[model samples]
Target chain A: MDRDQANYLFNVMRLDQGASVTLFNGRDGAWRAEVAERGKRGGALQVAEQTAPQRNPPDLWLLFAPIKKARTDFIVEKAAEMGASRILPVQTEFTNSERIRQDRLQAHAIEAAEQCGGTFVPEVADLARLDRLLSDWPEERQLMFCDEALFDRPSPLTNGDATSSGTGTPWAILIGPEGGFSDAERSRLHALPFAHPVSLGPRILRADTAAVAAMTLWQDRLGDWTAPNSDPVR
Target chain B: MDRDQANYLFNVMRLDQGASVTLFNGRDGAWRAEVAERGKRGGALQVAEQTAPQRNPPDLWLLFAPIKKARTDFIVEKAAEMGASRILPVQTEFTNSERIRQDRLQAHAIEAAEQCGGTFVPEVADLARLDRLLSDWPEERQLMFCDEALFDRPSPLTNGDATSSGTGTPWAILIGPEGGFSDAERSRLHALPFAHPVSLGPRILRADTAAVAAMTLWQDRLGDWTAPNSDPVR
Candidate 1:
């Protein structure tokens, strides 16, 4: 531990000398570390053996257009907590913001992981153009397109066996801006063979709420929530 | 619309004279109103015929212990947007905050309804003691209690005809504070015939994220999201 971390652990968290704390990196497994020294600014930690094996989050990626700063932060934080493997900020036609603070969003994701006791932290990608992304879309990955207009219509998504394919198939959840997808964008997305237009519900959910609801539904049906991982300890 | 609303619409939203806007009062349904006069301080609108009938939100209620100010506001707003009919703030043993701004939280709910184009606004109830509330619990209402410690365990909840009883049976989702429910509280809740202890997912979620996730999962499995309403429009 460095000076700032030592100060935080000793002062902020009120951990004393010989206090054991759990630590994890996105690559390494979770470990138990004990405080070796108690100092005003700097301290040392004795690293112990791994407590839990490294576990990757779901292969699901969340692609969303950035909205206001707070709401965008909320989306990133919630997506990370909800087990999204990666988060991509896409610039759509109706996207209000043209730029995003990638570092800040990544930090928010990290904070969310820390708060949620998640071992894996999802990577926050830099802003990318939606058209270019769609043009170079991967053939193997299926996109779960969240359509705002589809809420008014009947829910075409039946919960029968959407996740029967298991966790091997790559997946992505796409959420549009507050203004929603334009006619051209909606049509192109709907026409795509890999894109599956899903309705969240009958209500008109805000962009942030839609992102969470979509993630929850996807996790429940198609993600890893139903199947518990084997030989893993919390 | 009043003077403040006029200033907001004309100045903030940049709506000009003769602009058409939708209005809803929860009782009269949604109506198309046109600006009759535009002034610097005030404006007038001519209310047209109702465009959509009044639609009541789901009978599902959300009971959560109040946390931080912004997060509490977020819970209320999301509960309203996610089709919660009633919002109740319950005080648990580990609840950090003892008091809450009910009016402010209610206003947040209203603003959320307005932003999400929701015709029905959820009523935010005053802070109630959890034990007292549970003492007089309704017989027909089913409570979905979100247990943090159960995330690592198997999900005992089954979707098989759980909501088949239909909308006549009331339902509520309970989310604890960041500290989570006490062992005594969890035992009591699990022992209740009406309360069903459900796990959200594998990951540990923040209180606010837990609220949204619980609402989403319940809505998908056992709420009105599975069965759309008839006749009434958004």
Candidate 2:
């Protein structure tokens, strides 16, 4: 441990030689560790057996048009906590943010993963244009296009929606920036067969809030986290 | 308008006479206003007719134990965006935040409401002890008690669970602190008739993420944002 780390563990946290702590390295599952040596200069931790197996979220990705600095970081953090497999920043026609610091955002994702006790840290891909992503879109993967204009239609892919509520499919959620999608982009997304448009709610949510809301709706509707509705409302 | 406001409207926004802007004052619905005068020190805005009627979310409240400063602000902002009627920062046995600045948090709610195009701003109630609030809880208001411990149960109050999934009911969502609820508090909540404990998911979510997640689930499952599931899966 470094000096600051030693001070934190020894002085602040008051950890003794035999004290236990949970540790994870993103690749391996969570493991138990104990302080092997405690000194004023530094400390040594002895890794013990695994405490829990690695658990990953469903094959879910978050594709968002980057906004301001703080909101962009908030999206990445929430995406990690919501258990997204990967996070992709897409540059749309109306996207205001010209560029994003990938390293800083990736670090935020890592910190969020640690905070939420997530075994897997979602990879935050570098910024890419929306058109390029669409051109190279995976054929089998589906998209939950959160368009508030589609408020008249039922948003959730509930068990009742037999046609589109297909479970176990690789999925992604796209949240537009505050400026919203351009007419051309909206038309294209609507035309894409793989893109399933869904409404979040009556009152519109900001992009950051929408990210978390969309993930929750997806998890409730068709993701790995299933809330079994004995009476499934479509 | 004040001097700063005049400067922002005339200089920054480059607005001249007859430029239209939307306005709201919590109680009034959205209105369109036009610049009547462009003075150096101040400006004038002539109010037009109301454009949109007053709209509000369902009678849903968010009761959460306060955490750190930034996170508490996040919860309030998100609660407003997600359409919570009121936000109550409760003091649980393990709650870390001793107090909160209600005005500052309320300002966040106002900003979020405006960003979301919401006419009605949610109220941020002063910090109150959890036990006292629970004792005086309105019998009519149902509580969506979010507990990580109940991870095994189906969390959503879907169409099938008629007993607990009653529509048009006054409701509140409770998110515990980082240290979690004391056993006594959990037991009391579990025993309460009005409190319905629900798990967020298998992977634990931080308090801020949980607030948004829970609100989304409530909106989808039972709030005014009825997702008219054609095949209602119970």
Candidate 3:
């Protein structure tokens, strides 16, 4: 253990030898560990039995145009808490921030996982141009394009499992920036067969709010929403 | 117009006497008004044509127990944006904050409406005891009770309009505090006929996320999600 971690586990938390603690290794599952050694600057935890099996979110990826810093962080945190498998920051024509701190965002995802007791932490990808992403889009993965132009329509996305081939295909949801999608980009997305346009509701949600609401709709309709309980959206 | 309004319009925004602007009064519609008189601390506007009708969200109310300061603010803002007609903060057994600034939360609702370009601003009600609110609960209105204990269950709520009495019945969504509902409270709620317990999936969504998620679900099933686009969820 690092010095700060040692202090937290030993000095601050006041743990004695053989104290039990839970730990996750960012892959599948969590484990119960025991305090094996205690020191001023270091400590060791002995791995015990598994507490939770590896649980991951659906094959879902959130692709959004970065907005303000705090809201951007909020999107990542909420996405992580709401059960997104991966996070991607896409740069669109109307995207405000040219760059994002991938490390910091990853940290936020981890924090959200720990705070929400989620077993998995989504990987936050570095910023990528939207056009480039479209060109390199994976063939079988379906896209839920949350189009601003379709703001007031009833969502047509009813069942996620309806499209299930039983092979566990992946899905992605795209949220545009505040200024909205450029004309050219909207046309391009609309033309793609894999992209399915859907409305969130009748209110104009801010980018961050839209991200949460969109995920809710997607999860409610087609994701693991009706599955026997395995994940927590809190 | 108030002093701040006048200053914002005449000085900060640098609008002249004839500039055009839009206005919304909490009631029903928005109108385009021309600046008739510009003063240092105030200004006058001549009502022009109606830009949009006074479109209200479906009959929906969001009742939640308050959490931290920022997250409480988030619930109000999101409720307003997501088209809840009323926001009520309830005092549950586990609720931390005993009191809430109704005015500040009201302001947040108004700000959210203006930013999202909604015609109606949801009223932020003062904190009320949960039991009292439940006792006085309207007979016809249904309540979508979000239970943490059912976190892993598939939602039983499917269609909101399925129970239509052709009377435009009202509905409300309830979210518990961070620590979740007391056992007694949950049993009381589950026993009520008007109260329907629904899961927001297995993930333990924070209270704020639950509020938004519950609203989205209700809107999708029983509310106005299917009405021709009149509001925007963003």
Q: How accurate locally, in lDDT, is each candidate? A: 0.83, 0.83, 0.84
DockQ, candidate 3, comes to 0.66
Measured against the true structure, the TM-scores of the candidates, in listed sequence, are 0.91, 0.88, 0.93
Better of 2 and 3 by TM-score: 3
DockQ, per-model, please? 0.58, 0.47, 0.66
Q: Give the best candidate by lDDT.
A: 3
Candidate 2 chain B: 10-residue stretch with minimal lDDT: B225-234
Q: After superposition, how far is residue A147 of candidate 2 from its true place, in Å?
A: 0.7
Per-residue alpha-carbon lDDT of model 1 for A9-36, expressed as tens digits? 8889978778999888877868999888
lDDT for each residue of candidate 2 in A135-225, tens digit (9 for 90 to 100): 9999978888889787656645642532364666788999998888999999999899788788887888889999999999887777656
CAPRI-wise, candidate 3 is: medium
**Backbone clashes in model 1, listed as residue pairs:** none
* Worst 10 contiguous positions by lDDT, candidate 1 chain B: B153-162
Candidate with the greatest TM-score versus the true structure: 3
In candidate 2, stretches whose alpha carbon ends up further than 4 angstroms from where it belongs are A1-19, A35-44, A159-165, A227-234, B1-17, B38-43, B159-165, B227-234
TM-score of chain B of each: 0.88, 0.89, 0.91
Off by over 4 Å in 3: A2-4, A7-18, A159-167, A229-234, B159-167, B229-234
Order of models, best DockQ first:
3, 1, 2
